[model samples]
Target chain A: MIPLGYYIGLSAILFTIGVVGVLTLRNAIVIFMSVELMLNSVNLSLIAFSAYSGNPAGQILVFFVIAVAAAESAVGLAIIIALFRNKLTVNIDEVNILKW
Target chain B: MNLEQIAFLILAVAAIASAILMITRRNPVTSALFLVFNFFIIAVLYLFLRAQFIAIIQITVYAGAIMVLFLFVIMLLNLGDDKLLKWKLNSAKTISVLLGIALLVEVSYFVLHFTSTEGMSPNAESIGTVESIGKVLYLNYLFPFEVTSVLLLAAIVGAIFLAKKKFE
Candidate 1:
């Protein structure tokens, strides 16, 4: 059996990459993708703990998380499409009309 | 170093590499494709962890449904290669990279130092199967399951409302 620490370490690395992507990337869709990456990393950790602790609650929580992520991405992409129709660009820096 | 360990290493490397490529690529479509690949690798990792139901759901929902939606939006926008050549090593990028490194070091330190006192349950193998997940999900988590369905419905309506063309 693989050590649980290895799984946790992998999850952390992936989460950090997702954070970096969100911080550095300017495209709205890519940022959204990075958010999904973060969510997946969290899911991986949950499953790792589930496997290690032999609990079903963590897996069930992962199910809920996947459902929530799917819904979030649907609405988020729709909003992105709406934004694109108005701005004709997906760059985050250029979509600062509401900023002071 | 057994087969499982080797498999875990391979999948972990593939997932991290694909995620990095996904974030770094300039073309949104290319990035989306790499994200799909990353999702697949993650699904396989779930399988290795013996969470078969989640593995299947990860493949179907993430790689299949979510990626398709992303691709559709990418093509709909018809984004060109204009943004591809604009890569810059700005202050935000530098700071974020440093912060990300810090986050990785901190997390790995915790992961390596911490040890679990409780042993895995003897029934760990049986808990992750599809039937067991279904039983627990329907019995104990039925309310959340119903709420998820409602949430999905709301998302569908919201997507339609947001994306519809306005007729004035």
Candidate 2:
């Protein structure tokens, strides 16, 4: 069996990458994708813990995470679309104004 | 390392590569595709970890639905050839990258130092199956499950309200 540390290490690396993406990327949609990446990495760690511990709790948490991620994405994308329609720009840099 | 560890090695390499590709791509569509590929790799990794049900849901929910939604949003926006836009790596980018690296190092140090030597539990192999998971989820997590439905409904309403052409 592979060591749990390996999985957690991988998850950490992936999470770092996602953080970099969110910090550097200007596109809102791309930023959203990066957030999803971070979430997935966290899920990896959770599953690894659950599998090693033989606890179903972690798996259930991942399930809820996935479900909430789904709902969050649906609403998040809609918000992005709405923001796009109003401002005509998806670049996070330019959409600075809160009120028109 | 046996066959499974070797497989995990290869998949980890591939997953990291695809994840990097996903972020580096200028076009959001390409990024979405790479993210989908990364999700598939993670699903396989789940299978190797003995998480059978989670692996299936990882593929179905993440690679299947969320990514398709991302692709749709990308296409609808038509933010074509984002490379043409000037994307300079300012001090913020540098700081962020530095911070990310630092975070990775910190987490890795902890993981390496605190390697759990405990043996796997007896039911560890079968614990990830749908049958076992369902028993716990339906019994213990039932309230949360119902709340999740309410949360989803609220998300649906909120999405429609936000996206409506003219909100009254």
Candidate 2 has an lDDT of: 0.89
TM-score of the A-chain for all models:
0.98, 0.96
Q: Which stretches of candidate 2 lie over 4 Å from their true place?
A: B83-86
Query: Is model 2 an incorrect, acceptable, medium or high docking prediction?
Result: medium
Give the worst 10-residue stretch by lDDT in candidate 1 chain B.
B79-88
Residue B126 in candidate 2, Cα distance off native in Å: 1.6
Candidate achieving the largest TM-score? 2
True contacts kept of each: 0.74, 0.75
lDDT of 2 at B168: 29
Residue B106, model 1, lDDT = 88
DockQ of 1: 0.69
Candidate 1 — which pairs collide? none
Work out the TM-score per prediction: 0.95, 0.95
After aligning candidate 1 to the native by TM-score, how far in Å is the CA of B112 from where it should be?
A: 1.8
A1-100 per-residue lDDT for model 2 (tens digits): 6888889989999999999999888989989999999999999999988988888899999999999999999999999999888888888888877746
